[model samples]
Target: MMASPYLQCDSEQKLQCHWGLLLPPGCVVIQTSSSLTKMGCGSSIPKNCKVGGKGRKRHSIIEEVAVFVPTIRIPVDSDVVHPLRGLVSKELVDRLSKLRAHVVSLSEEIFLLTESRLEASVEFRWKTLDDDQECCVSSAWYEVLSVVHMLAMLALFEANLMLIPKDGQVGGERKVSEDAKKDVVDSLLKASGCLDYSVHHILVQIPAQVKKSFPCYLQEGMLEAISIQALAQCVEIQLGLASECEKATLSVKRRLACELVTYFSQAHYCLSGCDTSDSYGKKLLLFLKWKCMEAKAVAYYYHGLVLDKGAEASNHISAVCCLSAAEDLVTDSKRACLSFCLASPITRVPPPWGIMKNMHKKIPDAAYRKFQMYGYLFEQDKNSAHQSLPDLPEFALSLKPEGYELPSTDSIWDNVDSQPQIQSLKEHLNDEEDEVETK
Candidate 1:
């Protein structure tokens, strides 16, 4: 065999340059896109292109050039290789764990204090007090509820973070151990319980206390704001419960879905009075109303899932309708949010008395991504089996009794005639435009 041109060359670079020059003028030398492509090209090249062999044909030079020419390859990270690479730091996890424990302890302390105070009252009578004293009592009560709310929020964040693998891998390739799954479910259930308790205290207990204390003790605006806050919290907890119960038994999942739907329905009813006209309070209420709608969309999506997984063959059509309604709700919510953001000024306003400052923080993306995921799953498999419950007795035991009781759907439409006349989005937008023009 004739000595290969590569062997005669002083270096590989020279051989490559020579081969490049030997190629036909019109032929293009395209850079390979990846390492796999390069390897494929290397393997498929003609045998005559070997280092010591002669190429009898001119086309052999082109094949030799394709094989020997170096191509830049970018390294692609694979979740299979490093599943837990991007998870939160160990120190943060430890801190969150400690904080969650402390919150639970503090909640117990506050609940006991409130219970004792309630028991001491005679016919829920309030002691005669001046305006300042009444204000002090109101402030104290608001502060306690606010603290509980914040703690529940913190616990939720911690629980979600904990569910992420320590190795940072969130991809499906990483098979979660039974112990790890159990731990996650337990943590989430605990967090949901804390949130539910706080919401109940705010919505039911606080209102009863206010009623007993004195008329006008809590301002009307303050009471309205608090009710809205509690309702919002209720929606959040239900949505979280629905998410955590996704891998639970069909019955458990269905119960969660039912609760979610009921909560969403109630939230919608509460938000009916939210005025979106001009003031800061109205703007905040408008934002909250959009949030309620978004939450309802997610609940409907879950309800659809439950129906699809059930044994009834008729449920498939119901599932499709539920999903369709969810999509419409999401679209409307987005439009409402956009309109509210555009119409409302960014200037901060003093919150109404007893309403916490934290309540004004910008609302998060109203469950749009979550709705999309559910939609995708429904599209993928309308008949996919319900998720099997993990083998965790503690998780099962931790499920709150409240979820089992379904809310009456009739109550949702109760007193609908009494609701204030709220204008449609277009009319509201027009009113805003007219206000700007008058200015």
Candidate 2:
């Protein structure tokens, strides 16, 4: 058996070559051109028909079989094999040996553990936490393990790139090298695998910080970007070939909905910031106005909060506009579902002053429910404008549970429309009528 040139042979010779086995004799060759005449004798012939393995016939069936074989056997001399590549060369082998030594000396497991814990600390804002609070060191450890796994997968991917060949061409083989890595990523995501590595040496593992950094780094952003890229590439690959499912899944429906809600809230928050009469609020308000559109609920909610907080507070027009936009977006089933799922900073309702001013006539019911949702805010501590609204025209007092009770003279519900009634002296009339009926 011939030894590979890339491999060390059993013999004393450090270098070996396997050209004979690599491209054996009697191997047929065939070629086709863009514009061609009747190519001669496009048919099969005996193996021994020609001196150079290819028959005298211009085209042969055996040659076609050799060309069309599904198997790809990349030769050691291929570009992908090694940098200088006659085989795995002395330089590569030596380099690989050194790398192994270094890896062994440093210990990837320990390095990963230490690095991940430090990162997690930074991510979780552990340094800011009270020392008495027990830090979630486990998440930090897991993050470390996740990073290690990512590294291992990448290393294996590079290894496979050198080992696997898809077809005869060096290009084809190189293309498939990435497939292994993609598969590994896909597998990890599908499984939602957890890691056990740690970076406990660094900052505290605060929950909120940990949650934010974990996904953006570990897998979420990459997955999202890749998914979008795949959708685009697939469309370009086969023009007019999109299936119904693909079209729908890759559509902008969900994104549009999200953006619509996002902008309205930004507008509201921006306006509220302006009302604060402070540099911070003004700067934030102006920034938001420039950066965001008036289409998101979050913007509206935040603006309302800031406005209500500010000294020169009421921008009723802008506030109402923002709230209106937010309502429009969230009225839909999809947006409504998202509104429920995703918690926002400004979604908290403020205490009612007189009436819920931003409550739309069209969506009175939802507005009322929203008002009721934040009803507790009034109970916190209130006496005048900040107090719970009196049962006004919009919110009828008659419908309330306490409606049966008589109102005080100062109350709006007090009886000011009618005069006092007088009792009748009808005892003689009642007796005369009773006597006539009896007779």
Candidate 2 per-residue C-alpha lDDT over 340-418 given as tens digits, one digit per residue, 9 for 90 to 100: 2232211211121111123233233433544454445545534435332211111111110101111112111122321
Which pairs clash in the backbone of model 1? 83-169, 84-167, 84-168, 84-169, 87-168
Model 1 Cα RMSD, Å? 32.0
- Candidate 2 differs from the real structure by a C-alpha RMSD in angstroms, to one decimal, of 39.7
lDDT of each: 0.34, 0.26
Model 1: residue 378 alpha-carbon error in angstroms: 19
Candidate 1 residues lying further than 4 Å off, grouped into runs, are: 1-218, 221-246, 250-254, 264-278, 310-313, 343-439
Clashes of 1: 5
Runs of candidate 2 exceeding 4 Å displacement: 1-83, 86-91, 94-295, 309-314, 332-439
